[model samples]
Target: MKFEVTILGSNSALPTTKRFPTAQVLNVLERFFLIDCGEGTQIQMKRFRLPMSRINHVLISHMHGDHIFGLIGLLSTFALQGRKSDLHIYGHSKLEKLIRFQLELLETKLDYEIFYHTIFGTNIQTLFEDDSLIVQSFPLKHGAMPCAGFLFKEKERLRTLKSDMLSFYNIPIKNRHGIKQGDDFICDDGEVIPNDKLTKDAPKVRSYAFCTDTAYLPKIVPIIAGVDLLYHEATFLKTEEKRAKKTYHSTAEQAGKIAAEAKVKKLLIGHFSARFDDLKEHLEEAKNIFPNTALAEDGKIFSVELDRD
Candidate 1:
């Protein structure tokens, strides 16, 4: 399965010429999971040629305007496109009421089922799951009423059979499926071939973490530990540590420290404050702690490939 993430918006509370707000899309195989739809998110998807129909699951971290202002527009576009696929939304309870109010006031009935799952207190709860992937949410220390960070992990696949062993034993195609599923097959000659001997190990699972608008909190270390890629909000520099605490935000260095402590493979820091024009210092600060740290820029795609089984 193919795994990738695209940054739609990376700005903080306001929109700049280069960056918007917080929004991203994680493409797991053919399906897309939209995370935190901010202002101009639909426009961003159009810019990247992403199939709007492919996105049926939307995960909102909080009720902030920058994180949800684009939802109404996106839903309206879905309606205009004559979509009939069911859409599942996971967020806080208030978001459900908010979306319902908008749809009621506009008198626009959706063409498909809209399932809403409200996540109350976060304690590494599984918000949504399926055969391909599982998504979990954890509480964040942001000043909002309630905020969360999401973790996406691809489901484990069955092991593959060895070509030499398959033909050597004259294994039928029907039996091949059983062998791939870790079942031992008996040959006509009565030769015993163990599943472990005939098949290689399964591919390592890949996971991505999305965290934003939070202060430096180590409580999430276990929830986001050892992620393949982590996108953490770094709205300020170390010099503004005081301001970061006051505003319930994190510095680039703090974000890097968390990434390093969590042992994540890579880290993408964003949510830049309006004070700085150049982000070289921010990158330098993060890299000082986590060597694989990168800056999150709008309209940029980060690709990740999983190992073969």
Candidate 2:
């Protein structure tokens, strides 16, 4: 069961020599979920060797051009590739209209169907779920536009049956599923074999949170508390705190503080402003507040695993 995030683009409002914009791909157990689609996202995906066919869901944080400008191009490319599976998009209600208008105006017809799930208002809500994972959306304070952040949580895994004990108990193959679900086994002699003795605890549930293009809001701490990995936007340095606040973006230090307050295992800061030529200052500012912080650079991959400690 692999869980990881690959950064496609990390720059803020503009594309730089190295950075594109805001885009990421969360690979949960081999299934790809795209988060944001800034300009050049397809190129970045190809550069990183990520297969476009694997991405079925797209999560847009906001309506900002830097955050979603690449969606049309990606979809068109998918069509050109003769994709047949439906693509699901989760975002602000207005996004549906915007995408439809663009596709219609361009007279672009795709072979696959597009399903839009509208996320309305600023409330915390569950956006998607399956037997293995759950995705929740929460509102972010991003000025006039309706913005959101996402939390991805893996479901509690089934316990692993002890191989030695299974043979000793002569457990039937058909009963494995029940035992993994925490059921006790009954022997031929009617002896009860405890579930704990027959199986080992499964891996701990892992979680990741994505927060970007928002101001410093402490209320989100409770929603994303104790996540394994947190990707928060650090669009500016502490020296430009006023500009960050004015634009409803977070400074590097501010993003670090949020990670500390949320008690997440690791923090990834990105969405860098194009004005800066280097990220040394941003990394320094964030690391000063949260030592576990890492810079989110394009093509970087972060794995999400259980925090053994």
Candidate 3:
């Protein structure tokens, strides 16, 4: 039930001494999702002690070099390590083509299969889902590039059964599953026992949204609204708003505004410009609008703890 996101790299297009490009790993119930593999991402993963073997889903936001340069290396390493599990990559058609071209050019024979899921159009749609979790993709305002934002959502779980109550009512084994699914119990006397009396509330559903390398986009508010944690790109400060617009990147203030509008619980700002030697100002700028904002540092892990049942 562990849920957390580890920042592998946090720099923008440039690779600074303190920061690499953009890369992250989201671990939900040990199902790892690698997001935006920038240059040196493999090294970062190693440095952070992440188990690369656990990563099966790779989500690329776009075909930008700073966002995807390290992907080839990671894929190669997976082959070198003799990974057998099939890897599922989600991104634009161009990304699949680029990866295919590189793999062909290198003549590298992989030890596993790679399944590509193309992200197209501007509509928000489910990219992956299961009984306990779901991941969706939404379009970002990165000009000319088919970039996307991702939302990771934990599904509502079954109610927690109270052992003492179940025993007291002599609930049948066959009826326990239904009770967990929010059904009332009927005794031999035909008395209906309330579900609330027999079970505790289920854990609160958690959600995380990742939005990077995009311009100030308010249209994503509805899609990412009220998420438990939100990681948004702040590639510039408000002093360079015009520059941010020109580069189709967001400023710290803009990121904060988006978080506030979306009403997310916490905002994580990253994708910093190389010019910034210190990120204090960027954090401050974001805190101006969204007080619960924090900077996304390389190798840092932000965890969302499970709710009490």
Which candidate order results from sorting by lDDT in descending order?
3, 2, 1
Candidate 2 weakest lDDT stretch, 10 residues: 300-309
Clashes of each: 0, 0, 0
- Cα displacement (angstroms), candidate 2, residue 16, comes to 0.4
Candidate 2, 290: how far from true, in Å?
Answer: 1.3
- Which runs of model 3 end up more than 4 angstroms from their true locations? none
Whole-model Cα lDDT of every candidate shown, in order: 0.89, 0.93, 0.94
lDDT of 2 by residue, 123-230 (tens): 988889999999999999899988999999999889988999999888999999999999999988899999999999888899999999899989999999999999
Candidate 3 achieves a global lDDT of 0.94
Please name the candidate that would achieve the greatest lDDT relative to the true structure. 3
Candidate 1 worst ten-residue window by lDDT: 300-309
Ranking by TM-score: 3, 2, 1
Error of 2 at 150 (Å): 0.5
Q: Which stretches of candidate 1 lie above 4 Å from their native place?
A: none
Error of 3 at 142 (Å): 1.1
